[model samples]
Structure formats: structure tokens, C-alpha cells
Target: MNLFKLFQDIEAVDGDATERLGYYSRRSLLRLGSKALAVSAPTVMASVLNEAYAQSSSVQDVLNYALTLEYLEDDYYQKGNAAANLIPAADKAIFTQIGKHETAHVALLRGALGSAAVAKPAFKYPAATFTDYQTFLLLAQAFEDTGVRAYKGQAGNLLGMDVLTTALQIHSVEARHASEVRRLRGLRGWVSATDEAPAPVYAGEAVTSQAGVDLVALTGKSADRVREAFDEPLDRAAVLAIAQPYL
Candidate 1:
């Protein structure tokens, strides 16, 4: 399909066709003058289309997916902070601030989605989740790590939209949260090959290759350095599955 018609189809599905049009723009299309599209290889265009459909069904769908995860995290932190002696007195402020950030994230996303926002889901936690400090820290690390991947996972869906910027700003904050939580757990601030906590969170995170380039071989970097240099992205389904037990 032609680019215009393809985006028209997307607009029909998610009402985001206008935004796509605005992003690509009629002027940009006019500059191509039809000749550019006419001579381009069919396989190349097909690959482009395939990537688009694989990314997401709709921008709203991706946002709702994120909203669900934020709901779970906000609920976890709020409950943990409220529990008596759950967070140590010295570390209380750290968790309290993180919880506030989660709450604010929920509010901001809800505001952005308005009527389109999904309702919060009930969460399940281990019996010792809040009673044991180690348990709380482990789960917190998992959630924060998962949040970082989840946000990166959704990047493809948010491309060419204004909301991508806001999502990325939130992403940086999640990265900071993950690093702090890891340090509190007596680990390095970055995800590494050695970090085996909650296997799924660290799944596909130890790769030393990116964009088909062997970072270790070409850059002469150690495997650990290569792996740690790039934070990996998880697809939507994998992220949701990691969150399933908690929901």
C-alpha cells in the first residue's frame, strides 16, 4: 500500500492518522514528487509497513498498556510505604519519593488519556512482600527494571508523536529509580550479566551485540561492558507476562 493509504488505515484503527499525517506532512510528501516512492523497491516499502503494524495496533493501545503497568507500580509502592516498618527509617524517604513519582506518573498518564485511560487492575504480591525488607527490595528492583524495559519497548509505538518526548522523560526517571534500587540491594547501578534476580527482568539483557554489530569484537570492549553499554528493549507481550503474576 502507498504511505498515505497505509496511514489512512491506521487512522481508521486508532484515530492517530491525523497525527501521523502531521508528522510526515503533506509538504514532505510533495517534496518527494511521487517519483521517489515510484522507484523505491517494493520489498523495502513492505518491510517498512510490516514494522509499523508490528509496533502497535494503536497509539491509544500502547498508552493503555503503559497505564496498566504504572497502576501496578504505584499500588505496590503506596502499599509498601504505608506498611509499618516496611521501609527502614533511613531509607523511608527514598521509597516515599519513588512512590510519589509513581503516583504522579499515574495521574499524568490518566490526564493524557482522559476517557481512553484503562482502569487499574488488582495486584498480587508475595505474603512477605512488605514484611521482609529483602523481599521488598527484590520486588522493587524487579519492578523498576521491568519499568525501564517496558518504556523502551513502547518507544517504537510512540515514534513520530508528541507523547514520545513525555514518555522518554518518564523513562529517564525510571532508569534512575532502577539504579538506586539496585544500589540499595548491594549491586551495581546498571543491569549486568551477573544480575539474575527475577530472571525475566534480565532476559535478553546480556546481549553483547546490537544492530548486528559485535560490540565486543569491533570495539574491543569486554562482554560485560558491551552488554552494560546498551539497555535492551522488551516487546509488549513479554513485559505484560512479567507483570502477570503481580496482577
Candidate 2:
């Protein structure tokens, strides 16, 4: 349906990129006889919009992206939970809970998308990926942390109060998952400026300024604490690079 061309046309609209994209995404969805539902709701909506309107919208594009990541995470946790002697005895329940949460997220996103939902991609985890409990925890931390930032990065691109609110709700859950995973790994729940193994995920997160004020200078907080106080957003390219390994 020439979706890329539709996005290009959306980019040409006057105003900020976020506003333009949001407007076009909403307008296009409305043309399909649906209200802006949820950021994760896109598959069936995309199909209807594509057929009836002859074009796919940017909102559907965002939802498809979200669904892909959710599928990756859901599968990761499900595998980890089922792996033989992988998760430690004490931590098994925690992994179970986390796995359930991820499963629920996948279901919710899929339900929202209806028929337009993208099929889950085949994932390729290395042979030694989750063999060690510590290794599994580390990867879990990365996935959860990346998920939190990914949602934040796309907040502006979502349209409608309902859709934006739903995305934010999911974003908070991802942040909690990140914190829990960090705790399980015997690390601080919050990230510091020094932690930068995966550069794309933490890049620019060390900044101490907010609303033109130097937070460290004004509040006398340490740079690390300032960095922890706010989570930075990762652009789509950055997110994709971080997620590419498992896809």
C-alpha cells in the first residue's frame, strides 16, 4: 500500500515531526473507521487501513515495531523459564513472574492489533546464551532496560490521549522490569553514567541538564544520581541495533 510513501507525505506536513507524524497517524486510522486504539494495536487496523484507505499510517508502523520487540522479549523469558537448571532455585519464581508479565504484554499487543499484527520473527540465541544463570540475568537486564528506553523514545510519535496513556502505562511496567532484573543481577536498580556496555542504549543518558538548568549544579546532586533521575530515549535505529542480535 505504499506505506513508506505515506510516511514521507506525513513528514512533509507543517509543524514538528512529532506533531506531524501523530496527526497523520491519527487521521489515517480514523479513515479506517477506528479510533486511535493503542500503540500495540496495528495488524488488523493496518490491513483495514491499507485496503480501504489505500495507504498504511505511521501509527501502525510504530505499533508493528513495538509488537516485534514484545515478541522478542516474551520468547526470551519463556525460554529462560523453561531452560533446564538455568535459573537459580531462589530466583526461579521471579523469572516465572517476569515471564508471565512478558507473555501478557505479548497477548495484549497482539489483541490490540487484531489481524494486522506482524507474525513473530524467528529468533536466534547463541548456544551459550542462557546456559549460565548469570549470563541469562545479564541479557535480561539489557532487554528490560532497552525496552524501557525504547518506549520513551517513541512517546511523542503516538497519537491520541488514550493511545499515549496506554503507551506510558506499558513504559512504566518496562522500567519496573528493568529495575527488578538489575536487582537480581546484584547491581543497583538504577543506572549510572558509567554503565555503557551497549553504547546505543545508554548513549546521551549522562546529560545533567533539564529545562535549560544544570541539574547537578542546581541540586548539587552527583552526576550519577542526576543521570539516574531521568531515563533517556533511544531512537529507532539505536533500538534496532540493540535488538538485531537476537532477531
Candidate 3:
């Protein structure tokens, strides 16, 4: 069947699935026709909704964009946990907790979007290789930092007061996540320090010097563009490109 039908089927089974949440084994789920009913699975549902529903005119579009990235990060962390060979044994639990948090973030954003939740699109990451734990931490740092800046950059796009406030709240949490991960990597002290580490400063401070600027696009750019650090706020298209590989 078509994608929309698949998502509908997934939602139809959600009541039963929610009852099984936290307890259902992957094998048991398969026994229950999980694969046959998988059209409504999270990623599939997202992809179908993305193609079927277009939020071209609503603030909901931006929220779904953020939700999509959250899904990607959530999935990536889970994959990392499964590939236990790549992640340290001691750190697997840490990664699992982070994955759960990312899942919660995605669910929250998706709920906020309500009827406007977009379908999930395919996503991927850069070809850059991660050589070791240090490299993985570095990349995690980059992803977390990007997430923080993205939320901040889109804060203005939210029109509802409640929506704006909620988004900002999540934005702050993302910054905290970035900070904690950075500390784990031995980059900084606790949140009170003034070290050269990367955490969300006020809107216009440096994010990261290396990926922070687009010098070629600097023809009379606003103060916001020149002063802030981190990779320039990734527009939806750029965000999708970074996300598609992981899907």
C-alpha cells in the first residue's frame, strides 16, 4: 500500500503497542506481526507523514523540522548502543540515557505539532570517519552544539507564546546536554566556568570558531551572523541533508 496507509496502520496499532511499551522484546514484537504492521512504525510513519502533509504556511513546520532532527539523534544513539563494539562498555549506559532523552524530545515536539507533525524523511551523516572514542565524542559534541544553535535560530519562527516558551525551555536543555557531553570529553569544568569550551552563550556569542562562519556568505551580513559562533544556523534543507543518512 501507499505510505499514508502505512502510517494509519501504525497509529491504529499504537494503543496495543503502548500497552507493551518498556516490556516488549523485539522478537516478541515480531511474533505479533510487528513487521507486517511496521508501516506505522516511528520512522516509517514519520516519512509517510512528511510526504503527505506539508506545513508550508504554519509555525508547525519549524517544530516538525526540529522534531525530525530529534528523531535522527535518538536513532543514532540507539544504533551506537547496539554497536557496543564501537562504544565503551562504561559509556553504553550513558549513551542509552541520552538516547532516551532524545526520544522524549522527539515525542514532545511531535505532540506539540499535533495534527501538523510532518512525515519523517530519510537522513544520513557526513562521511567523516570516527577513529576512536575521542573522535566519537568530538562528533557528538558537534551534533549537540548544532542542535542547540538550531533551536535558538528558529526561536523567532514560533508565533505562539506558549510554543515559544516551550521551545526555549527545550533549547536550554539541549545546551545542557552539549555541556555535559563536552565535560565527559574532558573539554570543560562544570556549568559555572568561563573556559573556552563550547556551550550556548547568549544569542550572538561564538559557538565554535572552526565551523562557526561562512566567510564567503559574509557580504554585509547582520551582526547576528558575524558575532555568533557555531555552524551557521542550518536551514531546513541543510538540516535534512545532515539527517537523511542516519535514516
Candidate 4:
């Protein structure tokens, strides 16, 4: 929750981060960061965040975009958790906890958007998505991975605002969900460049450099190791392409 370091990291990834963070200059962003750092009165912090997001039509669109994904995940987990024999008893707790997080995320994003929130759409899945454990695991892996990348892709759109902090927190949870799902599927906790089974979900993940720094060269690590160390963001168009089947 280091606000200053968070802003610095965002700028490192996307140099124009502050410019899009409520149209603020570096000075204004630092001032906001200082306020967020102080952890003063709750109302004062709330007012600052409201000012950052309440007036932006663009932020509303981002929230709605996020809501769609949450609704999809929430519905998926609800049906899975309710199914009599879908999830194995031993892993029921894991999925149940995951489902609750999704539901809470849906509520949080929906409340923020209020009237502007997008209505939940009917979710569709492959045959035996829940009835078969292996199928269920596969689909969960894909959904969770897509969710993580999708959130990271939206980070630049929500830079200096406190909402960005909120998004990052959710992003962290999504990543844990992805890692757990991947491990259940017998893969490592991280995505591999060769894991393109679900087509473009793992596509474009083979990069070796980030922020103009060659990670492999800098760290003296193998290319695959370097690739596994950093996550690649998926643009909205790419994420929607992957999400189309579920909506």
C-alpha cells in the first residue's frame, strides 16, 4: 500500500500513466499520493477518490468492463459450487472461497457503477463444463488466466486514482486464483509460453524484455525463466475476443 511506490511502478510500466490519471500533472499526482499516504479521515480519502472517478466517463466504462468479467466469474462459480458432484469434496473449500471472492468483487464494482453498471449477461460454457472435473479444471484455468491479464491490461487506464489501488488489489487476488487453478491442472504456478492449448490465451507471452530492459540478459536467466517472471497484458479487443464465447 505504498502509494508513492505504486505510482512510480505504474509510470515505469506506462510512462503516460499520470497524464491519464484524472488528467493530473506529476505534481498533482504526488500531492494525491501524499494524501493517500497519510491515511487521514476516511471521509477525506473518500472525497478525494470520488473526485478522481465520479466525473470521468472513461472510468465508468472501465468499471463496466470490469463488471462484465466479475458477473461472468460469479455466475460460473455459483453454478459450479451448487452442483452436487461437480467439485471434488477435498477441493470444495478452495472453489467455495474463490466463488465468494468473485461475488464480492461483483458487488463492489456494481455498487461503484450504480446505474451505469452493465447488466449481467447469460454465461455460456463448453459441454460438461461442470459435470466433469477435468473439464471444470480446464475451463477454470482459462477463465482465471484471462481475468488476470484483463485486469493488468486496464491498469494504465486507472493510474493515480485510488480506484487504481482497488483494481490492483483485485488483480492480486485474480493472480492467486490463476496460480491455484494452474497448479490444479498439473502446471506450474506460472504460465508457460508453450501453453497455447486454449489458443491465444497464452499468446504473445513469449517476450524476453520489458520496459526496454532485457530481463534475460540483465538477470542471466534462461529465456523461459525470464518469460515466466513477467506478465504480459492483453488489450481490450483481445480479452473480449476470448470472452465472447462466455457472454
Candidate 5:
């Protein structure tokens, strides 16, 4: 898949690149309630990205990984939205909004990378992945939840404050998407211990400790409630494993 060409098509349909990029736009950066913040660099360089998993790193790798996820999400939602009689009338707007957010995320990450961006991988969804509304919602929940954890795992890799801030903003949005999808599935907004999946997306999330303080001991909260209170991060390897099937 020619990732650049796909981005170009989105740009063509959306007009101005800034608008297409959403929150990462220059104007939006200034409007982030802090006039001093801005993304000064255009391209974050391939070498920096190559060393991303080695502990300390640049924003390039994080943005590139995020962009890839955005691409997958955008394509998934677009396909789901396009499938005739697949989505309910009331739920159509939800998918539309989520699709727009994913598209904007793609534009933002691509614009940030400039020439250093990775090419979009050829995505292959399962034959029955989107055959019906329930199937589509389940997949959507998985993707959004995985995306939320993926971003959280990479948060420590971002070097720039501005970049980290942007990533957090996007992360919050993904969490919201996950919640929305879960609600559509008639499930709780957060993952429970009983939640079953091929991968450990919610692994270690049930712990109630932080900085040596146990929430269950401190606040008398149930383990499940504590788990729901905070979502765990998934390392790069885990995220890639979860995402590999789609790509």
C-alpha cells in the first residue's frame, strides 16, 4: 500500500492540510490554551526513530507508530461505514465521528513526519470481521482499546513536551472511542478481569497499587473498580502483536 498516496487523497478531499490535520494544525497548536507551545520540527529523522525502542528516543518513532494506528482505524471505520445496512441509523453518527478523528490523526502524524514517515502497511481484515453490526462493533472496541493502551505504552518515548502533549490529547480521544464502542456492545466502558481476548490487552490493569500505595487498601475500592479507574499500557511488542493481524 502506498501510504503517501492515501494521505494525498485525504488531503485532496479535505482541502487545506491544516484543517485535515485537526488538533496538530498550526492554528490549533496556538489554540491549545498555551501560546508558547508549537511543533518546531518538520521531520524527526529516521535514525532517531530506529533507536526509539532502545529506551530514550525522539518524537518521530512515536508519531510514526501512532500514524500507522490511525491509518488502520480510519480504514476500518471507513469500511464499516460504507457497508450497506451494517450500522444502525442511530449509531451511524458515532462511526462517522470516529472515522473523522482517525483521518485527522493520520494527517497530523504524516504532516509531522514529513519525509521520514513509514509507508502504510497492507491491511487485511478477516473475512467475517465486518459482516454484521455486532461483529464490527466488537472489532472496533478491540482496536480502540488497543490503541489507547498502545499510546500509553509509548508515552515515555516521546522527547518533546509539545509532542507528548499532542499524544496525550490523542490518547484521551482514543479512550473515549473505546468507551463509546463498549457502550454500543452493551458492555462496561472499562475492561474487566473476565474479559477474554487472544492477547493480554488488559494485563496487569487490575493492580490497585501506585507509588507503594494500594488503592484497595487505601480507599476500600474493589479490585475491578480500581482496574476500571486506570488503564494499563501495552509495550511496543504487545501492541505490534495485537495489530499484526490487521496489517
Candidate 6:
């Protein structure tokens, strides 16, 4: 599909009742709170999105697919933090901060989409292959790294400047989370040594299409490819399939 059409499709599926499920929007928050927080401006200016135009049949599967990942990350950290022994005392504080940040992100995205935000499907991630704390860190490193990239990958498909900007904001934070996790894992830096270090990039920030660049290049992958690695944008059904096993 062409880019705009793709975005519209994602937006359409994202608007359905199944996606909204149990959420209630206080119009007060929808107006005043969202503006104070700068949530509504981008989508409104770019897409002219309104509740009337949004329908369940019109929701975009890709958007919901992306939302599912955010839910997964938010829930993972929430649950992960509760496992007292899972995180080191020194790191627990920061881990909770990241968890809270992810929580806010999910909430922010949901609010921006209004009722179009998809439901959090019951999910269970595949059993982590790690056997030790360090190993788990490695997995954590991978997950955060993947998150940083995934957000970037999806940004282009978003038409509303407001939605794009908000997504970009979250994307940068995810990068920070990735860097911190990498450091904890004893990795030299967030980016591979051959790649630039400490620089953050996002999918919504720019548009580029490259495949498997991270795997092929020593410079680590560009921020955008991290999103692409997960492959095509997923619809609701596809997202639930992957996430269901995790829940």
C-alpha cells in the first residue's frame, strides 16, 4: 500500500471498539489535559482526526500492532520489577522509572488515539532463554534495543504530525532505556563500538528504508532499522497471536 493509505488503514483499525475495549475518555482530559500536555496538536494538524471519522472498520492494524508492543513493554517492566530478585538493588529504582515511563507512554498513545486505541490482548512472551542475571540482562538489552528500533520503523507510517511527534518523544526515551540497559549488561555502549554511541534516532524523525542493516553492518543498526527488523506492520489478529503466548 502507499504510505498515506497505509497510515489511514492503521488508524482505521485502531479506532474500533475491540481496540478501545474497556476505556473511557473524559472529554475534559481529551481537550484541556491533552492540550496542556501537547498531545492533540500533532494529530489534529496533520490528519484532521476526529471521533466522527474514526470507525472500528476504519482502524489501522499497523497502529494497533505498534500499540500492542508498547503494552507488552509496559506490562513486562511492571511485572519484571515485582520480581524482587530479578533486578539488582542498585538498579531497581531506575528500572521502576523506566517502567513508569512506559506506562505513561501507553496511556499517552491511547489518549491521543481516543477510542481508537486497541485493547491489551492477553499475551505471554516466549519463555526467556536466559538462565542467569547477566543472561537476563542480555535479553533485556535486546528487548530495549529492539524497542528503540521498532518505534522508529513505525513512525513513517503515522500521518498525523501530532501522533508522529508524540511517538518520536517516546522513541527517544526508549533509546535512553536501551542505553541504560546496555550499560547494566556491561556492553561497551548502547550502539556497537563501530557504530556511533550516545546518539538517539527515531522512526518518526526521518524516513528511510533499509533491511537487515544491523545484522550486516558492524556499525550497529540505524535507529530506523530497529523497527523494520520486526518485519511488516502487523494487524490486530497478528499482534494478538504473538502477544497471546506472552500473556
Q: What TM-scores do the predictions have? A: 0.79, 0.77, 0.55, 0.78, 0.75, 0.55
Question: Model 6: number of clashes?
Answer: 27
Question: lDDT tens digits, residues 75-188, model 4?
Answer: 999999998889999899999999999999999988776676789999898889889999888888888888889999998987777778888999889999989988887888
> Which regions in candidate 3 have their CA more than 4 angstroms from the true location?
1-56, 126-131, 189-247
* lDDT per residue as tens, model 5, 145-224: 99999999988865344567788999999999998988888888877664545446666566678778888888897988
Better of 3 and 6 by lDDT: 3
lDDT for each residue of candidate 3 in 128-238, tens digit (9 for 90 to 100): 323366666766766676677678778766544356777778777777777777888886522223333333322224332335555436546544444432333545555
Pick by lDDT: 1 or 4, better one: 1
Q: Highest TM-score: give the candidate number.
A: 1
Candidate 6 minimal-lDDT segment of 10 residues: 198-207
Tens-place lDDT digits, model 1, residues 1-247: 4768667555543454455445444445566567776665454445545545554356768778888989998999999999998888999999999999999999988876666689999889999998999999999999999999999998887776667877898889999999999999998899976557799888999898888999899999799988888899999889989999988
For model 6, the stretches where C-alpha displacement exceeds 4 angstroms are 1-62, 126-132, 193-247
How many pairs collide in each candidate, listed in order? 0, 5, 19, 0, 0, 27
Clashing pairs in 1: none
Q: Global lDDT for candidate 1?
A: 0.82
lDDT of 2 by residue, 1-247 (tens): 6866554443332113445445666666676554535553576445444443332345556667888888998999989988898988898888888888888888877776667679999998877767888778878888888998888888887644345676788889888888888888777788775655556667778878988899999999798889889888888999999999899
Off by over 4 Å in 2: 1-56
Write the number of the candidate with greater lDDT, choosing between 3 and 5.
5
CA lDDT of every candidate: 0.82, 0.75, 0.58, 0.80, 0.74, 0.56
Instruction: Assess the local accuracy of residue 178 in candidate 5 as a C-alpha lDDT between 0 and 100.
Output: 94
Best by lDDT: 1
Could you tell me the C-alpha RMSD of candidate 4 in Å? 9.9
lDDT accuracy of residue 197 in candidate 2: 52
